[model samples]
Target: MTSTTTTGQERKAPGRPRNAQADEAILDAVLTLMAEGQSAAAVSIESVAAKAGVGKATIYRRWPNKEALLIDAVRSMKGPIPELAGVSARADLIAMVTANRSSRVQEFGKVTACLLPELMKDEQLRQMHHAVMEPRREVMREILRRGIASGELRADLNIELTLLMLSGPSMAQGLFGTETGVPLEEFPVVLVDALLRGAAA
Candidate 1:
């Protein structure tokens, strides 16, 4: 069902400038379909074009191919940079890892662990992932920066490498993360305790 009118507040009201709604619809359809575990490659632009009710040009105008499109969809679904305003950096960091559903993390993990290697060979795909992941990664970096500044964390810490170390265990649980046999509620606490102890002032 395609509508001619836009759907937002007065200023932003004309939500989709140019069939933007259709583009959004296309992305939404792709996510809904991909969630069923379909390989991103097996999905076709024609299908998305049809689903979004826009011409194929519309999709390509925004994304060159399925991978780019999928990455965009993933970025759209990205949750707010997990943070606890005004809390201790330690508490904020713990909330960052714990507040969200690990299942979402695992789903992303499976895609990254499996698809990334294959995509790595393609420069376009690599850049696409960077474009998608960079903003979110910056959020974590900022969190660490705040911790370092406030003396809750050691300044000598390698924020970049530290990110991997901090996120490693949570991600290492593999494909289904929780299926790694760790309990749901315990993940953030265990990860926080370990990471904090290592980085503590």
Candidate 2:
């Protein structure tokens, strides 16, 4: 005699089919909430699932947890790293830093800062943050390396340290400098000029 599997007990498919539109919708929903300064406490799977117009199951099928979903949303804020060639190192660095300070990136950074305490306590969240940030860091290293090679920057300039110097202020501002997200009008200009001066060969 054949046995029957009860409801919610049947062997599920290995996985549900991928849905591109649904994925985009979910990410957009997360960004929308973050840009509005919604607290992490308010952003749960149930809420995002509803905002995305997909079931909670769909979200779980992809992310398995809230942190993973949030990480992906932050990573998606950076569409593609722009080409860093075809310009002077100073010009390139300025463009790169300014481009990253765009409205969407700033919004994502602010949300990340807001969630920093919790993220720091969790290994998985820290790993995801590194994974998202490492590529961008590498790109800046390449630019700095080029600057050194071209005699624009000091030959002994430490790439990693310089990257930290350039990016740290904006990140701090997002985290603690302002509540309304101050405009980076002269921030990039002032920061870049100071960095180049210190590193100039």
Q: Write the per-residue lDDT of candidate 2 for residues 64-160, one digit (tens) a residue.
A: 6788777777666554566666467788787778766766666667776676566667896777677666767777888888888888889999888
Model 1 C-alpha lDDT per residue in residues 1-201, reported as the tens digit of each score? 111111111112235566566655876766555555656776688877776778888777766667767665555443445545845777777666763334454455555455556566789667766755665566668888988998888989889887787666655675544464557777677777777786556
Best by lDDT: 2
Report the Cα lDDT for residue 78, model 2: 53
For every model shown, what is its TM-score relative to the native structure?
Answer: 0.63, 0.70
Query: lDDT at 13 for candidate 1?
Result: 22
lDDT of 2 at 155: 97
Which segments of model 2 are wrong by more than 4 Å? 1-21, 31-42, 176-190, 198-201
Q: What is the lDDT for 111 in model 2?
A: 75
What are the Cα lDDT values of the candidates?
Answer: 0.62, 0.70
Cα RMSD, each candidate: 6.6, 9.5
